[model samples]
Target: MAEARQLREYVPAEVPESAAPATIEDGDLTGGATDHTVWSCAGNLTAVRSVRARVRDFLARMGHSETVLDDAELAVSELATNALLHSRSGQSGGVMTLFIRSDGTRLRVAVADQGERAGEGGHSREDGDDFGRGKLIVDSCATRSGEYWSEATHVAWFEIEDPRPGLSLADTAL
Candidate 1:
């Protein structure tokens, strides 16, 4: 993992009062809470490990053991990789940021990037397909499930159940 540079503080824009529940527009999806850690990452493959390391470290500070932190780090890596590869059809050169927050009961991670839109929902890869399985892995990581959403200049995030209750992040079913 490379060292992460401070690009800028993540300043969340407000969702309009009239915004619908569970849907966000023109703002950070702080994922229903503000007591989250924000990590700024450059929009390159190299940024993946740095962001993953940071998430695991934050979880450790929150009292998670190394074992649990490893699970979360794996999920963060996948999400960051997908964001860099699929979030845009061309260059993803701006930055990728990770927002991590947990409340003991669950842990949520949101990897945000400035790029072309990558829409919501999940898709499966046929046996021979060579690509497009990132979301499937992410879906399993979520304790409940995971989702994706996007807009013109930003794609916010998805959340999965943090590894707890004996549910390994990799053991999650698609």
Candidate 2:
């Protein structure tokens, strides 16, 4: 078995006040000229709803279509659920973090949990299992998925291309 990776210590830098509300406090990981939003919460079941709401609000501010918004929200929810249910982050006093970044063309979502490995010792499911279908939903909606371990945390991310390019908030008439 492969040894688990450890998470590196990070200190969030202060962004300028003029920065966009969604600006990344941490370093940019999405490699795009776009704003980013981040959230950190206790690793518990309730964090799922909080993360989903934040994702919806962020996408709305970015003028994403209703379909895209729904897809992003669902994907984030699944990621958070997995962190809370399968990772060490779900333990008491553990933490989970979420990041969202978007350029005009694509949206990326990442969730990080303080886990030794990606879904380490997670619940096993048989072929006919009704639960544990979150990954399927994520794969169906996202154009791409990525996973990596940093320090003691496992990060899982997904990206979705914009359905309607060049549509700004003014264009949406919102």
Candidate 3:
């Protein structure tokens, strides 16, 4: 007889400290180059790749420098990966949503998942092993990043402060 193995899910360690959780409200993006777009896809293992690609393309088209574009892509990927691993969104028939907002000076990317994860034996961060713990990368590179939950979804997001607003790397003199 074949043995069935339990899936091991990974959740990232919490950020050391930040402001207390509060209401999630969208602020104004009052800048010349302002835009907001959202995308949704099946929240499975494959979402990490697709989400990263979309975010990269979206930011590229927004005329952001390569540094910001790369950092935003990495940050978004980290957030998405976390949402998938830690929430029910990673389960079958689940879905994940990506929210992006930019004001030519700063860009914010958010990933919304179904909710907290529940599995036979999925939560394991005490082993001292590392595979899915990368949320810190987001916190390190992003200018401002945090997470909040709506009634139905667990959302994590980060904001990048662009050093050169409205400038694309394509026209750089370097």
Candidate 4:
């Protein structure tokens, strides 16, 4: 068998609370535990695959179950793709940032790009296949999803609640 291709690894640095994106509330999901990772990449189509792979690796290392793992990966993929396809961040030399945080019970994924202001209308395809389907996928997979805009960046995020062991979906009101 051929050897597997290794994706470029991103080493997340400890960002100061003040430097954290305004969209992401501090100490909210991590429960005061600052376990998070950040990846910066060119705002291009290829970045979507890289971000998804990184998300999978990160969540797996965090001991997430297979179901949760798949959802998280899909959610991130959709969000990242939206940023590239619809935002200025996808322009040449533009940059997008991916942030992932976990606190044992929950995980949050946020993608920030230097793009159009939130709510100022985003990109859509000519095909009449229901615009904004990305948010739909994110909504179905994540427990919560939202978007935020600052003077310089547009940030979209999703939060997933990891199912507790020995509990079925019917047992929890997620």
Ranking by TM-score: 3, 4, 2, 1
Query: Which structure among the candidates has the greatest lDDT?
Result: 4
Give the Å error, residue 2, model 4: 39
- lDDT per residue (tens digit) for residues 34-151 in model 4: 3333344445588888888888888777766667788989999998888776776676555667778776678888887666734667546565656778888999999877776665
What is the per-residue lDDT of model 2 for residues 1-174, given as tens digits with 9 covering 90 to 100? 011122213212122234323423344334544433333444458879888998888777776777788888888889988887777767665667677777656788878777753445545576455667788899888877656664566777777888685465576776
**Whole-model lDDT, model 4:** 0.67
Per-prediction TM-score, please?
0.58, 0.69, 0.70, 0.70
Q: What's the C-alpha lDDT at position 105 in model 1?
A: 39
**Model 2: residue 124 alpha-carbon error in angstroms:** 2.7
**Which 10 successive residues of model 4 have the least lDDT summed?**
1-10
Candidate 3 lDDT over 140-173, as tens digits, reads 8788777765545666877788868556566565
Give the alpha-carbon lDDT of every model. Answer: 0.52, 0.66, 0.64, 0.67
The TM-score between candidate 3 and the true structure equals 0.70
Order the candidates by lDDT, highest first: 4, 2, 3, 1
Clashing pairs in 3: none
